[model samples]
Target: MKIVIISPLWERTPPRKYGGTERIVYALTEGLVKEGHDVTLFATGDSVTSAKLMSVYPRSLYTDGVSWSNAYWPSINISKAIEYSRKIKADIIHSHSQYYGYVFSPLSPIPMLHTHHGTLKSQSIGKEKQATLDYFKKANYISISRSQREPMPYLNWVGNVYNGIDVDSFYFNARKGQYLLWMGRFTPKKGSKEAIIIANKTKRKLILAGKIEKNNRNDYNFYKKEIKPLIDNKNICYVGEVSQGKKVQLYKNALCLLNTIKWDEPFGLIPMEANACGTPVISFAEGALNETIKNGHNGFLIKPNNLNGMIKSLKDIDKIDRLTCRKWVEDKFSVSRMVTDYIKVYQKFVKK
Candidate 1:
């Protein structure tokens, strides 16, 4: 089947540093191509993919230091994708862009599937809420997790497909190294501050690695007031946004990954990545972490915002077998499995 994947303009496919959505899109595109399907990736010019790549922008908006007000790019990108789909008589157009798919789905003659990568509560606010209600029925939506769909149960959802990763790329280390890990955006919702608290409480060496874009004042302020003060370099080390190689090393070596997210994260890739590395994750029971972390099996899932729970889980982290963590991802979150599941979704809408 011929498939076109629409990626966000902010980052390249399989972003060098920090981009969850783009990474998932890259994995999905590669997986489909590996399975002998003809795939075309609609992304930034710099995006690297095995499939044919179509782009409107020279590079990622953020990477090129482009201003955020240049919002016309998304429309242009979507238009290009729509035109390409019609020209090629594509079997399906799978969109990872949050809003564009819904906006243009009705205009397209071919079947379109959109993977909802974010929380509905955040997206469905004022005018966006009305727009969603208006155009939701025209598009087929796929949730990243069952928990993500709870906020908008009324939407026309096809199914839930969990985000997946390339397990082979992530090397597994059965023998874990010293120090804990906290990797994500340096934001309040991500609970970087809480990770510091947990690290201090448990007296474990914690390595914090993630991006803090220059435009995000709130993240900068949060880093200064909440995270920076506590960094001792020995206990809590702040390693700014890491490359894929560094990320693999961190995950493979860390004792466990701390996912102290305070918000309803749509779907976290870090936890699954950690699992792929034979590393366990200690996450709060919020959003998709509930499904991602298997208590006492691969990792422990504590109650949200419960510091004591985090402290206690750390004590029992040794009980989690490293091989179990690796096996869990192999069984459930491999890229091959994700591709097979998505192919089933595509076959449902493809013309026989």
Candidate 2:
């Protein structure tokens, strides 16, 4: 089968770090290629992939430091990718762009399978977009989690494929380490402040690692005001953003991962990534965390925003077998399973 994947232009496929969505794209594309499908990936030129690559931009837009300021970049990226898909005579066009492909699905020559990778309740998704999605009910749409389908369930729901990671890459360690881990962009919704409070209350050494996007006002101010002051370097350490290799090391060594997310995240890859490394995760019971973190099996899930509950759960974190955590991800959230599930979704539309 000839397939064309429309990936996000913000980062390279299989990003060096900090790209959960792009990682999925790269893995899915590789998996499809391994299965012997003729695949073409539309991503930035720098993205390394086994499949044939096509791109409108020479490099990722984020590296330009002006992608946020300019709206024309992505507009042209997606536009040209779709135009090229028809030229290639692709059998299936798989889109990872949130809702930009919704408009094109109406008249697409090839059967377009759109994967909704974000929460549907954002400011960008206005009434007009919602109405447009509702109108295009025949278009096949895939959700990352079942909870993500809450806002717009009327669309032609094809499948719910959870975010997955390459388990073999994340080396496992049965023995827990000294410091607790919190890795994510510093934001109010991500709960860095809450994680600090838990670390302080529990009297455990905490390591905070993730990028602080200085260009974004909300993230920058939140880091300086709320998160930075708390980083004393003695009890709490802020080890900027880590590369993928270092991230795996941190996951393997940390006593446990803290995912104190305040928002109803459609699906979080951090917890599953940690679990793949034989590390337990203590997360708030928000959105898909309830499904991602298996209670008493891989990690514990407390009530949302309940710092006290999270702190208390930390005490029982030892009860969780690290091997069980690894197995949970291997059985349910491995990249192989994700690719197979996606192939099933594609087969529903593509004829043999």
Q: lDDT of all the models against the reference?
A: 0.88, 0.87
Candidate 1 wrong stretches, greater than 4 Å: 67-70, 122-134
The candidate that achieves the highest lDDT relative to the unseen native structure: 1
Query: Which regions of candidate 2 are displaced past 4 Å?
Result: 67-70, 122-132, 135-138
Model 2: per-residue Cα lDDT over 181-289, one tens digit each:
9999888989899999999998999999998977788789999999999999999999888999999999999999999998888899999999999999999998888
TM-scores of all candidate predictions against the true structure: 0.96, 0.96
**Candidate 1 residue lDDT tens string, 1-352:** 9999999989888798999999999999999999999999999999999999999997889877775556588778988898999999999999988676688888888888999898777443456554664566557999999999887788889878998888999999999878999999988889898998888888889999998866677778888887888988888998889999999999999999999998887889999999999899999999888888878999999889998998988888899999999999999998888898999888989845
